[model samples]
Target: MNVFPRLPDNLTGGLRRPNQVRRDQLEGAVREALSRQVAVTRPLTADPAGQAIRRANRIRRRRAGVGIALGVVTTVLIGAGMTHLSGGSDQQGPPIVVIGDPDLSAQPLATASVAPPPPPPPPSSKASADALFASALIDADGKRLALPGVGPAELAHRLPNGTGLLVVGAPTAAGRSLWVAQDDGLVQVLLAGAGQIVLAPDATQVAWRDGEDLLVAGVVGTQLIGTVRIAVPDSAQPVRFVGSSLLVRPDPTRPGHVLWRPGADKLTEVPEQDTLNVYGSLPDGRLVSQVSANSADGTCLALVDPLRATKAARTACGTRLSPDGVGGMSDDGRWLLVNGKVGSTDRSLLVDLERLGTTLDAVPVGPAVSGAVAWTSDSDVAYVDSSGWLVRLNVKRVRAGEPAEQTPVAGIEPGDRPVLVSGS
Candidate 1:
């Protein structure tokens, strides 16, 4: 305590002044000692601000390098992923590649075993005319020689092949049974109580009327496949075959309606506004009918599509007494045979259906006709004269306005009415 010097008490406010001087002396000595120590421990470096800036720059460089390295790693990973997805690999063996949905379990793909469609069927062939007629005619003695259980056939129609014939009214009870005669001397009874038999154009089918019921039978070669009965109006009468279908008309009691069967199953009635008489059927299922005009004495011809019977086309055949009689179409469907009285003379006219508006006024080749007529072929027509003689007329020459040459058919004799069947 005595080693320290004291200041003047009067100038420093006594005891407080002496303590303050001692404190100031001690603080100055400590400050000098700390300055010397700091000087001896300090490192040889640049300014503090420069060092801080350099440290900040180093931090930024480290971050950028880390980012670059991370980017390189990500790029390499992406490249490897793309290569794997693209089926590219560094392995020597074949690479394993997966297709379809990744979330779905792998399955073996199903294979389809499809069979090719069957080849189309071959087209059918048609028979010749001479071959057909040869099968129909009887022997020289005019007797039913080949057909058994048949006596004196009234009407004979040849089948498509020359080996078979369809004969009607063999000398049986009521003359109603139909018989099929073959060239091999085999005979079969096709139907009983049958009338008005008609063969289809293809000769694969036949239709007939048994009183009020209509029967259709299918034929293959010389055998009858089956017969189907179709119910029709009691007044309907079978007229002709429109292809494999059958066309029928009402009797005089029911004049306007016409019925047809698509097959042997059912009948479809044709509607008519006025009284119409069906004369012939076209190959395409159209009907040629006689329609009355303003006067009762006059009539016109109309072409009607049976499927659409409401639509009818009236042609120039509306003259007085024209088409007084109805006939049939030729085998080729080119000519239509129509009969009418021209100036008190019974005349046969051939309408050229193929030529549209052309009509041929046929000259009588034989005696006056008895209204019985049939088409033998595309170019020929056969008609019965009043004397019951059959006359064959050339249709082509008649259409050209030239006189139709007529020839007498040998088998048809005088006083015997004939039914002409054409071999198409």
Candidate 2:
């Protein structure tokens, strides 16, 4: 009765407290989780000034730690191409971390470029040979010599093999007569109606044009054997040999040329061409011709496809040549002798092909007597002078302002025009 009413016994039983041991275990687990979530070394003091000072010190230490980490990141970045940064919630800026070894420096891709092939090697050691000056076969010493089986001829050219000479006579009703002046002095007259005779540069083959028939044969020790006749489409004149292929002009008035193999029927025409007739070929297969039109004076020489068939490829022009002067390339194709005029005088100029495609200037040896010009040696150029003497001019001597060595080649006055031999 006092001031409140009495509680029921059953209510007291239902209001029992939680188990003490379980409650203690649960409280400990909650305390451990709170401790992990927030770490604290010491509790804050009740003084406001002390708490403010402690907070300032903690901030300064954190800034110093981040600075040290940034220094480490900068050192590593010096040796790495790139780096990454990982910042935590508590940090203002984080250090960059590097992974595996990476390229220290990056560069751009390279550009493509190609270089042209080099020129052919020089010839082997010089050989003892004879010079043909105005139809007269003369030795290197400029003495008139005679081939045993052959007599005076109209035109002649040296065989590339230096084995003999190719002699041709005036064209009669039966056509021009041809013969090979052997090294052993045996002359072999050509068989099978050979005309327009053109010998291969290798000296292993010979070819001629007979009507529409193109006759090619193997040269076996001064003999033209194993003849193969192929029918061509036109009256092609044999021009010159570019390796095993024969270069022919389809028409004398045409501006181009075609190449044909002896054993095949296919014809290959040069890609870019002009009216210049290819009279000589380099061992590398470039064509050398005469370009007279639109030049300064005399005759201008040109080099076609110095590299290949592209308009960007250049054409080199030589200096003025004699109006009707003689010119020929050396056997090694290293030097070019053009009958050129300096002033009122005709001089045999040496165009050093080693400096070809660069200059048009030439080295004048002297006045040539006969129109014939030939290479006497790798370094010597031979020509007949006004005294009918064979002048051998060493290029080095001529370059040094020295005189040419003259030898008595012939004593004839005139009427010996048709019997000349040369490598022209």
TM-score per candidate, in order? 0.56, 0.57
User: lDDT winner among the candidates?
Assistant: 2
lDDT of 1: 0.54
Cα error, candidate 2, residue 179 (Å): 1.9
* lDDT for each residue of candidate 2 in 254-285, tens digit (9 for 90 to 100): 56677777777777776555634555777777
Candidate No. with top TM-score? 2
Per residue, candidate 1 scores C-alpha lDDT tens digits across 1-424 of 7798876575655654334557788999999999999889565675888889999999999999999999999999998875653322121222121121111123321222222222212212422221223222332122212222234545556677666666666345553655565443334455555666666655577777766677776766544445666677676767666655676766655446555654436566665544456666676767776665665546666666766647465444433334434565776666766665566776666666655431222333334444435555567666655554455667656655666444444655455444444342
Look at candidate 2 and give me any clashing residue pairs.
134-420, 135-419, 135-420
Quote the lDDT for 196 in model 2: 73
Worst 10 residues of 2 by lDDT: 96-105
Q: After aligning candidate 2 to the native by TM-score, how far in Å is the CA of 48 from where it should be? A: 99
Model 1 off-target regions past 4 Å?
1-155, 170-175, 262-266, 273-277, 319-326, 355-377, 407-414
Model 2 superposed RMSD (Cα): 25.4
